[model samples]
Target: MASVEKVGNIEPMPKIYPIGGGKGGVGKSFVAASLGALLARHGRTVALIDLDLGASNLHTFLGMPAPKDGLNRFLNKHAQTLDSTAAPTPVTNLFLISSSTCSMEIANLFYAQKIKLINAIKKLPFDYVLIDLGAGTNFNTLDFFLTSNKGVFVCTPEPTSIENTFRFIKAVYLRKIKQLIKRHDFDAQAKAAVLDTASNALTSRDIMDIVATYDPEKERFFKACIGRFQFKLILNQFRKNADAGLGKKIETVCNRHFYSPFEFLGGVAFDERVIDSIYAKKLYVKNYPATASTMELEQIAELLANGQPASSLLQPAL
Candidate 1:
């Protein structure tokens, strides 16, 4: 990947993982922070970016009493480059680019600002860059989530969380479709047919059928674009073996319902110490090494570090 200095000038994009769940209190910032600590422990240089906008608190999770500088500096032109805004954390080889200064208005970035931020993030000089996205499927949240080399979705067993998780995935997929077709014209009839949100043209199959009806050749290529959307899922707040199976169930539903690759990378059991660590101002992975959640997160981090495929996530770990 390119150094943060040369991001906009033909530098390679870093391996970025944007973590988000559709709802708040779903453990996205926690997962992002813990994963960043674990990756640093594994000897990889990692950056945890808080893109939660107005509700940003990832710095607190990382034990940052006060992040004096961050993304806002770059956005406001106080910092010339994105790298300069990254603040050091207690963990070695791990840094943080917080959104603590962002307000509700900052969440809605201008198109030019969005492009600049994305370019800088893509070229950060780190082995891994994990973005903690905000709750709900807003355009900013979805756009950041889509910027990842591998998007990571965090959800608990709660029915609402599960449903929203699916909604978030579908939103991202459909957004990609819209992005692809926005630049290239299909047929006027096909455009009007699918773009009509009131209709039942919701599924990938439905859209493909509409496109195929208009032009068979374009349908094949558009289907390929849809097939490229891939992401990893982590089930959090798991309390029992039944809850463990929720990950598998969600994966199955997504595989059957969506066109892209979705994998469940094991679940983090509910551990009281996680909260205790949070209150103690220490990273859970750093303070509670023996906790079940910490161990499971380490396994997930190992798999991610090793470049394990989505198919491999089906197997149990650690």
Candidate 2:
């Protein structure tokens, strides 16, 4: 279920996972950095692309000064390819494509430019590619999260964070359904049905009903395609007092509501030492390898590397 690209010759598909949540301060960057380091420690060459745009700070979490070259160079055409901007990290097999040096307006990418960048990302050569996306339901953020079927959403165990995360999920899921409709070349009426009508926002069931109304045969195809998306959820900043099963409950609810399956990939406990490591510019997992957060992250990393649940059938063949 891996995606393949042909750049000069056939290239293996790196398992691309875009980490995102609707709201900031949920530890998305930290999760990306930790997962990349853990995967690299286990011998996978990983590329961590910070797509946090204007507020990029993944470099700080990784304990490295911002790399001189990054997405800015690639987007500005100063660099030939996205791969050229990958800077080595302290970890042996991990690389980072920092967005810290990008201009203030970097987040507002033109549609064509956004597509070009997404295509370039698909062609990146690595065993795994983890994208740290900015927080929002903007087109850029949603599109980046859809870059791969294996998107990991992070959220704290709070009402606002969880609510925003759900919004993020719905936005991405809707965008993906629309993409599938376009990619599969659904009929004119089917396409028009999904178009926003001021009063009613389209839901997954609504889209499926429209497809079924247009072509019952295509409905099956559409459901099958949607089912292939395997999204994973992570509860960040978890505490002993919070519901221990909140992540699992959310996963069950999401799986029940959405067409795609959701997997609860455990939680990373809140630890003050994490802040200490960040202030000191050190990788938390490396500095506190025995902490509960580190252990849970390792488990999540292992699942990501070894699990074979599903992958998107609609991701453009780069």
By lDDT, the best candidate is 2
Cα deviation of 175, candidate 1, in Å: 0.6
lDDT of each: 0.81, 0.86
Per-residue lDDT, model 2, residue 273, is 93
The prediction achieving the highest TM-score against the true structure is 2
User: Residue 150 in model 2: shift from native, Å?
Assistant: 0.5
C-alpha RMSD values across all candidates: 4.5, 6.8
If scored against the real structure, what TM-score would every candidate get? 0.88, 0.89
Tens digit of per-residue lDDT, candidate 1, span 119-189? 78887889999999999988778778877537999998888998898888878876666665555678888
Residue 271, model 1: lDDT of 84
Going through the candidates in the order shown, the clash numbers are 0, 0
